[model samples]
Target: MGKLLTVFTPTYNRAYCLERCYQSLLRQSNRNFIWMIIDDGSTDDTKQLVEKWIEEDLIEIKYVWQKNQGMHGAHNTAYKLIKTELNVCIDSDDYMSDDAVEKITDFWMRNGSNNVSGLIGLDADLNDNIIGTKMPENLKKSTLFNLYNKYGVTGDKKLIYRTELTRSFPYPLFDNEKYVGLAYKYYLLDTKFEMLLMNEVICYVEYLPDGSSKNMYKQYVNNPKGFAFYRKELMKLPFVGKKFKFKQAIHYVSSSFIQKNRAFIVESPERYLTVLAIPFGLILYLYITSLVLHK
Candidate 1:
């Protein structure tokens, strides 16, 4: 039978740091997963590095090179190509724990089903510190959204998803834009299925200065359409509270100003909320713009 899980990494010009992730995969106690690398138009030696690794034949690897699209676009291609029943993204700058694959497969086999999306696990730093607080041990299943807003779970956690669900809400691509919030798809999946939670640390992460997480202001300035698209969808979610929707509206307004979309209020799902958010949004827009300019 084929591997039960696919660990995919979407990368662009990260050849220098990609080896850390690759080496970590090689150390996996369980080799029952496939490693798929989606090369998002990297101008570096990424292809050459991956080619060498393929020759080593340490574990199953699938590498696909495509023209530069942002991280979301690379995810689009990865989901399309993945044939495994389950998938998780291990960022180019991050590495998995040696037993992560073993833990994930065993957990899923014991508890996974179509009724639940997949599972959420912990992420640690290089020193083995958990990025966020642990999941509520007594909790059985919860959507990603609830885990944060409702339960007050903090920090970044690892997510494993059913490949089919990951493919369901594809991030929209816009001209000259490279980023769309990855959570756009996750929130949509929440609408359909709640995820199982496991407190085990599965991945180690390092936030590089140039990483998207570190340069969100630049992302906002450069990818307003993508941001706008994400905010609009978040505002439409039914499970979240009005306060959450209002927060989304504020972001939507800010993104609209960046995109210079005059019809933002007319197009918003919550027009009244957007109207109330205009001043805050404008302030946020100026703040983001100032950061980008000074950066």
Candidate 2:
């Protein structure tokens, strides 16, 4: 038997968009993967809809529910239960192209994984518009800093990774339920493994009006403590180079300065003060982000 691929979807209160994802999986040209849904405490009819799919037997589905812990928590649960050689995450509101699995599997088969840890692919919206097409060239195996700063790899486009290399995001880092900076965790695997960039578009991300990034400003305003936690974690990444280290430090200090709550700053006064001395923090942030394009 060939190695199984587990496609994990972490969802919360997104019943309306969930079907698009399920339907896409049902139409996949390849059926060697299992669709694992980790429901993060949705009080809506999400469970009913998922159960209906299970009854129809449209695809190999596993529905797991847990108390509301946030996206990372749901991912942690899914990662633990997925018994597949390779794993991928399709957001609840997103779906995959019909040929996505075939393309990914074929790439793995041909490449033979001498040093590849996972695969990355183009992410598009429901309209099939490219999301990060203009990202820096030769971004394959770029550091987390390079990904977010130089290239816009913050979005959900990457594909299945080796189960052994995946790690759970540290729970203490998140103050509320928001999921930011989680992508930084992927850098942990970058040192030993490089990702294969499959020029093909595989995932379709639905831009939900209420998505996490939509309320980013509010998230930062209301949860400065959590934002502070995220900054500290980013600074500690072993794979990040000096530029990202400085950028992360600047981000933390800037956020503290903008929020003006002095609590986290008071707690880490030395670190916070050091960031202000960097001299061109805002300019650097803008320059790095402006490089993203859809080419």
Candidate 3:
């Protein structure tokens, strides 16, 4: 009960920037958290740097090195190992605001309940710009799906989950497919609960050129099954509207075609929508093909 948060960072060959993340954790005003670093088979000096940090014992540091799995895979491992009541992901390229842990636990302890999922907080760029629109002033809680599709808030937001809730829904790891959408699990949880919204920025993000968000086309090419699975799951969600499901269906069709899954027409939940999307799906298929080939 002493530790309230586990600040997890999943890293793969990000040694150069990893120190920055570690230093930020060291500077946190509150030390009531464990910094868990899951090293996803980095061939660089990442292992040594983490070891040195552990030896110094500046903060509670837990290090686990596993075979190279993509970001989602590392996330799965982190969720399993975290014993804290609350958890948040601080990407290797990102760091928390010095008081992030304090702010999060303070809110949770004051008002959090098992009735809700956890907390939904903000993420800011290095320049301190909130990534998307701020949470609605009157709103107190929202699910991941509704906050975007309903409220029209755009851009990435930091999510802090009750570790138990997150652990209950693990990300599926497809063979040779390391790129499952992390949102897949978040959306699944949305059906059961909502998160208390905190308008304060919890984490600072830096989108490097090599990050997953930047090279998505390549990801779609390399991990079509993952993308297809994500889209298919979205199509099955009961809460989303036709418009949202329609978009998921379109992407599902495209990803299905990427895998050359001939049964996509039959597999789709939105039969007519999938049929209509075929033409657009084909265009998207070709567009992705060109991008993959050109790169």
- Per lDDT, the best of the predicted structures is 1
**Residue by residue across 181-285, what tens digits does model 3's lDDT show?**
999899989999999999999899999987899999999988988898888888888898888887888788888888889998887778888888888888888
lDDT (tens digit, per residue) of candidate 2 on 25-87 = 988998888899999999999999999999999778999999887776777787778887788
Q: Which is the winner by TM-score between candidate 1 and candidate 2?
A: 1
Give the best candidate by TM-score: 1
Give residue 289's lDDT in candidate 2 (0 to 100).
Answer: 39
Q: What is the per-residue lDDT of model 1 for residues 54-161, given as tens digits with 9 covering 90 to 100?
A: 999999999999998899999999999999999999999999999999999999999999999999999999999998788898998999999999898999999999
Model 2 — which ten-residue stretch has the worst lDDT?
286-295
Candidate 1, overall lDDT?
0.95
Ranked by TM-score from best down, the candidates are 1, 3, 2
Model 2 clashes, total count:
4
Q: Give residue 32's error in model 3 in angstroms.
A: 0.2
In candidate 2 the C-alpha lDDT for residue 150 amounts to 58
Rank the models by lDDT, top first. 1, 3, 2
| Model 3 pairs in collision | none
